[model samples]
Target: MILENEIGLSSFRNERQKASISILYTYGFLANCYEQFYKMHGMTNQQYNALRILRDQYPKPVSTSFLREKMLDKMSDASRLVSRLSAKGLVVVTQNPTDKRLVNILISETGHQLISDIDSDLYKLDDLMNGITEEEAVQLTSLLYKVRNSLKSTYDNTVTEEQVHA
Candidate 1:
């Protein structure tokens, strides 16, 4: 809705600007869904993402830097988020034995159980995509990848050209 208001998408739709507008609109919608999903657990989106990452890393310790790298948004403060999870007793943090300067993180038993309890609620989020069939989802994914790859190539070309000009 915000994208619709700000982007004035109706005019450019079905034209040259459609791809970019569609990407922006889709992101806005997905972000709203993310907000609603996290709200059910009284957690922020980043916090939920951190918890899920930790769950996937269960039985193995993860580093703050490693988490930052894996996060969907690179701007997130992984160290601070990990600290908050530790404070909530949902994660345990300790100094790495081999490298005192680095910290190791593990999902606490509480965190494991919490994720398990919320599994159903998380799946309920799939309803947001119910209008699309499985085949459509796959096609959407392929088109998205194509768009991303094209963008990446364009960016790389620009960077290389700039460097050459410099």
Candidate 2:
């Protein structure tokens, strides 16, 4: 169902309503797209994301903190996510040799194969952005970045409060 129909909100009243509707729809769409995108890989979105992060750091161990910084989902539990991948034999987590205080994560052979298999499928997922042209995608990214920068304080506060309550 359409968001307007589902929410019974024909039009927003003022800036507050516009912002709320934008946030709601943007989050909903991204979440739905993520669920569908990860389904094809036989993994949850978080698991897939962790695998990708490990791949990115291949030949170089990544710390939990580093993964946390790179993840799109700020709420993700890096330690738990790495543990889950380790359990699936998709990743390896070990105490850092140089720094015992830090844990290092690396992608496994199976993880590499899994990612390779999904590369082709990723094209289909990428196609979802076809709603906008290449230039538009760039502009949209710029706009999103600007918005995030402009509202950093408010966004951070909201997220921090949510996490505290959660």
List candidate 1 segments past 4 Å from native: 1-10, 13-16, 156-166
Choose the strongest candidate by TM-score: 1
Q: Give TM-scores for every candidate, taking all chains together and pairing residue i with residue i.
A: 0.83, 0.82
Quality of model 1 by C-alpha lDDT: 0.84
- Computed on alpha carbons, the lDDT of every model, listed in order, comes to 0.84, 0.84
Which run of 10 residues does model 1 get worst, by summed lDDT? 7-16
lDDT of 2 by residue, 1-166 (tens): 2656767778667876676587777778877997988886788788887778888889898999999989888799988888888888898789999899999899999999998888768877778788889999998889778778878978899999999999
RMSD for all candidates, in order, please: 3.1, 4.2
Taking the tens digit of each residue's C-alpha lDDT, what string does model 1 give over 1-166?
4555676644654554666876877788889988888778767788778888989988899999989988987899998899888888989999999999999999999888877777768767778889999999999999889988998899999999999999
What TM-score does structure 1 among the candidates reach? 0.83
